[model samples]
Target: MPERRPTRSLPETLRTLRALRTPADPGFWRSPVRGARFTAVLGVVLLVGLTLLFVTGLLSYAAYNPDLNPVNDKTPGKGWLGFYLFSWPTGPHWLYRLTQGLHVTVGIVLVPVLLAKLWSVIPRLFALPPARSVGHALERLSLLLLIGGALFQFVTGLLNIQLDYLFPGSFYTLHFYGAWVFLAGFVTHTVLKTPQAVRVLRQGIPRGEGGTRRGESGTPRGESGPPRRGTDTLAAPDPLPATLSRRGALAMVGAGSLLLLITSAGRSFDGPLRRIALLTPRGGTDPGPGPNAFQVNKTASAVRITPADTGENWRLTVRGPAGELRFSRAELLAMEQHSAELPIACVEGWSTSDQRWRGVRLADLAALAGYPDRPPGVFVESLQRGGSFRKAALRDNQVRDGRSLLALEVNGAPLSPDHGYPARIIVPAAPGVLNTKWVETLTFGEL
Candidate 1:
């Protein structure tokens, strides 16, 4: 017998298999526009999640006090969340930590998404519709502001991580103010887009004879075919004379662009940058660490000065109502020394680890300065001089806050000059603005 011929009908076989496949099919799903939008939206959501976490975490972290946790007793088992939700459980430390972690993780995801989304949507930017007069200009202005702010965040955030060497202080100032600008644009975009979004959803997708095109090519409701490649082909022009009617494919694009701007504004910064200036490099003039970075002064600072060659001599001067008290580096080192672990939280919303610091208590040092029972103020000067002074008003409450220390050592090592050598004040929960460094003068009474 002749070899039995394979009797499979290839077209029929393929058709049968395709018929078995659904949009819900588990395998090799494909849709380009929807996929890109989905990715874009995902990026927005992650960004938003990060923002929520950071803001919430910061509020919680500021309020948290680890001392409250009951160390002696064994509490019933629950993970960190349960601890945060129930008992004293270390206040919001765990919550802040978890959210901060999420914020960072999402930030990492955003790098690629930021590039992809911008590449995908940038063509649409230059193709914006023409506006009429000042009102139109304002609307466009709002959109521009939104776009600019978004771009600022994305760019600064990335730069912060990679290029700390180039721009050190830039991150400190711009990152703070840019957040507000972004928020304003976001709110405006959402307000403007709300009605259009509702209209689009209400009308739903249009279909007709011969797999007819709907709103636009490659859109969810506009057109559908094998997913278009790089650029989805534009739909055929409307047969109806162009009226000002918003019931067309162009309206959909407008709504989407609006939505993108709104969503991005509201949530894009939610990730790591929000928590710790994500793109910002670590370990600079004021690099953020947490409570663990604390330690006591160990070096015999005949005078503890760093960068030891700036033509600046180390000096310690104490002036107050009781009278001017001055000390050479030798005099400060002669004073009684003590050590404690403390936390230093900065206003930029980052902190040193549980830092073990050794130094004289500010209270003790104040007494040495012969302060009144309640001296009015203190001033710390850096060795570099030229109008660098941290003037602190020493109220009764500050005097009593035992956590305040004239730190001479950090993390079990003598203070590095970058960290304010010789001595600096470590005040828990105070911002970097308040944590005085290179203490050359302590002036009490009015400032």
Candidate 2:
């Protein structure tokens, strides 16, 4: 500065800045396990697990019937993203439960593998001469998206499961969009690197080559050579003594995944097995010792639904082409009563075991609304004062299902206030939210 040294150009300044960083020197990353073979094993596992996670996540969105718009659809301006969406089916009664459960459980289990995969290739992130060409620049950009998207998805998903709504905006919208972005980067990276990864896997880790010896740049002992390039970037230029072998590292990651699986999978089941899912939210708890004892996502108080609101004054409104008919809780109970054991599964990946639900069939209600033969879509509205899913629109398949009910009692007991006392909607294979509690109105129409 004293001599007014010539100002360096932007590119030159960036190069110098990169040179000073510890990561810029391959020797700074002294882990012997950071190599192509190690990375390939982790990558293959992620490729399979992440693919399943994505499909199941998309299926969960579809289960919400997002195409209904302003009703259950949270993501606005989805455009072509909704192209592949189909009318969510209403069969097997546990479809949504299984899909959403897999989505969440697999995502949680893959965390350790994802971390290991990143660790094996982190040196590539700080390679000198950041962009060797336009193609290289594109590669780096994709990598950035891949890492960022993955972290964002996992963090948001975990927060949702914990019922922590710290993030601004709707979780459904954010998660839906984030999934697409992650998929793009994932597809690109997979295409670009699959061949190399396959080749590395085919040729397993070399024997007796645990790591680059200390003070060596991946060259044979007694020889001084230039640092490695390309795929060899993961090889430390000047490594430290090996503390853990590559196979040992892989085994550790597998064990971690297995542990998470054991602790999370039980949330989808009932009885004694469910007690083992210590890591899952709402797991291992005895809600109470009674006929209606089970999980409840939101109590009447939590949703600002007061006792008076669901008292004798409350009436179920059924509207359609025929006419508008209203019924009191007693009137609904007087009508033909049906019973179905359906599990209530939530998007947060929690599910209650099948509970005995007794109520009038939705199809019967639709008939009162004039659509007796083929029940049109029904928009079920809740009496809750606040919260999303106050209203939800069910597709024709769901409404026509014999098991769909406007439930009056659960487990042979009149519903408690927290369990949607006056009335609630319970449909097989539908998400818990769609089973609108404290149901106020049912409008049958084309939509």
Candidate 3:
């Protein structure tokens, strides 16, 4: 159906492409805001966002193992090279809730800033004579790692939030190692570029040449002959017009960030904000019936636990330094009972509203077993096996903390099978899975 249009020879096509690439310098069409000041401002926002993301991400990973360094050892609690070394906080009881909430929230909000930063300097990739020297080449390498790693994190993370898994490999492992690699590149690039950034910022933005940044002598910047041996050219900013003025861009970015926070942060806040978090996955969908109508991460049918067996044959056990003790549902219900309002926060960035949980405190269970709190921690066992968080450890702080519970009922009704019938551990601030649904046993003195 096509008209016979001849294809050009490879050499001719290459020549055409090169000729097309020789358009006017970017300076002619761009507005003043597409200058160093704009980039510097966006870069600063990106820096703060990255710092928060890295810190919180490390904390979330360490939370997987309470005894690990990232969880048990690090700063804010102390000063060990500014790394997270202290055991994840137990006193506040909602420490994981806060850190993880910030982690996802910041990552989502920083998307715009990241995009702006990339748009500001991508032209340098195409500048004539791609690499001026070996040092410049190295800087380009680091920049490549930084951009690639950051984009990878953002895409994978957002997909994870939606519970989507398209790529092969463990998300946790990939993201974990990727964070380290990204940090390495970020530090190297920052070290290489800071002086130029500072100089351009001081000179006032939108310099003379088209997107030409302050760089080594001999480039479009300073002297214009041969670049001096020790120096390299600065990154040229993009030529996007300030249709949105510099201040306007920042404001739009802040507004977008705030909007995302208010809507998505419902996954953490669990208060009045829950009603307004219209975009959150947990909001509209039916959790069927459970605590505050809580959403179930793993259904009974999915885990192959039958409703009949869960109700009639279930028993709870606690093993500690003293000994092992077992109890039926009625026996547990008959004991000194307490209730609290707590949230079920998931690593997938979805959380339930405050559930009115009625249960026995973990400390009481350990006392019943004759074990007092000590170092190391307790190993919690779940009835259903074959899932990644079916078992989790509770450090001394968590076990001793009165907020931790082996819950029996929620919202005045016994727990539904889908919501861990008979018994489940509901700890303060622990990831939803680490709370160990359908709990079976508690063994103290485990690493």
Candidate 4:
């Protein structure tokens, strides 16, 4: 009675397994381009890329800590309802600059790998359930979130970096919130799938190797190492696809990522790479008046303000606790001038090399305007009438720091019109928007 073990013929068993998959999903299983090896290859690339992006992105977020960031933001100061309680390091002035650059560059380059990974697994979307259990359902749900969240982060982030505001609503808040949701889904999926990925990879080429001979355990490694009861599925199908090989697919994804990294890296790259980064919009050799001459986000002509407005009669009017203190261009230049090297960073993630900026200190202006020696806050108003950031409020640190300036010159030359002309606010560790240009007024006090 114990000798009754039986099995199907070899060809019959192969036929049954071939028919075991789903009807609704695309048949990637049938394609030469799809298999565990190909899927695992692209998956590893995407996994690493996405992990880096998330870490760097969170670091960038920390850099904007209300206590550390010079911009007077309302949210972080309150500590996200007391949940996220951490401070960004104030050391290494270039830290945020480097992290954000890496975040954006990694994101752009990883696009190809993400797409290929999705393509390889598209059939699983249609796979008939091997079993209909709660665990299976949960895995599927996580997959949905992973795909959706990854696409959201990549699409929205790229558009923002390019300065294209086609999407409505606040990109900053939406993107930040989206990142948390994405990270949750990614962790869940990784936990459930990584063992299988590692096993498939360990089994060698698609044909399987070592202990994974014919009739070896089809069951995963951590499970009881038995030949999976009824399923003697081969450890692999075919090592190379009939059409595109795994090597070819990996090469394409890698090439795409490299191209993206080079073009979008901008002046954040130095050495010889900076010269060859053809897609970089921030240039060190550009002829203008701001740092590296100038890197114009929005030009004066585009904003439609006349040169006369910023010309000889231009005056910076400071309304303080005492009264209004006004200064003409020559008068500000005549004051004790201080110069500092500061990098102007944009929320879009591109940052300039620190430039030699010379001007009067903002704290000095506050003092001259009869405010307390160090006001807790400063409000900057630009001559440009209509723009979202025509006005900006500065944090306590920015107002107190001597490096903060009403800069009149860059390097040795006065600012060009596009570079904010007669003067512009230049502050340490502040967003470019807070450095309001075409100066008109300054008010130092409560926000």
Candidate 3: tens digits of C-alpha lDDT, residues 160-210: 777788756667766776787788888776665555466566765424344
Candidate 4 lDDT, tens digit per residue, 45-75?
A: 6778789998887666555554433343434
For model 4 the TM-score comes to 0.77
Q: How well does model 3 score by local distance difference test?
A: 0.69
Error of 4 at 149 (Å): 1.4
The candidates, ranked best first by lDDT, are: 2, 4, 3, 1
Angstrom error at residue 382, model 4: 1.5
TM-score of 1: 0.51
Would you give me the overall lDDT of model 4?
A: 0.69
The runs of at least 3 residues in candidate 4 whose Cα sits more than 4 Å from the true structure, single-residue gaps closed, are 1-28, 59-91, 198-244, 267-275, 280-292, 370-375
* Model 3, runs deviating above 4 Å: 1-19, 22-33, 66-85, 198-203, 206-255, 283-291, 321-323, 372-376
User: In angstroms, how far off is 213's CA in candidate 4?
Assistant: 20
> lDDT of all predictions, in order shown?
0.46, 0.84, 0.69, 0.69
**Top-TM-score structure, candidate number:** 2
Candidates ranked, most accurate by TM-score first: 2, 3, 4, 1
RMSD of each: 16.0, 8.2, 6.9, 8.0
Comparing 1 with 2 on TM-score, the higher-scoring candidate is: 2
Query: Candidate 2 residues 1-447, lDDT tens each?
Result: 378777899999899887674876776788777876888889999999999998999899889888875688888689999888888888889899889988998998999999999888888787777876687788789877899999889989999999898877788888889989999999988886676567567765322233334533322221122434223445676667889888999999999999999888888877676789888887877477787778887888989999789887999999999889999999999999999999989888878788999999999999999987999889988889888889899988988999999999999999888888899999999988999999998999987
C-alpha RMSD (angstroms) for model 4: 8.0
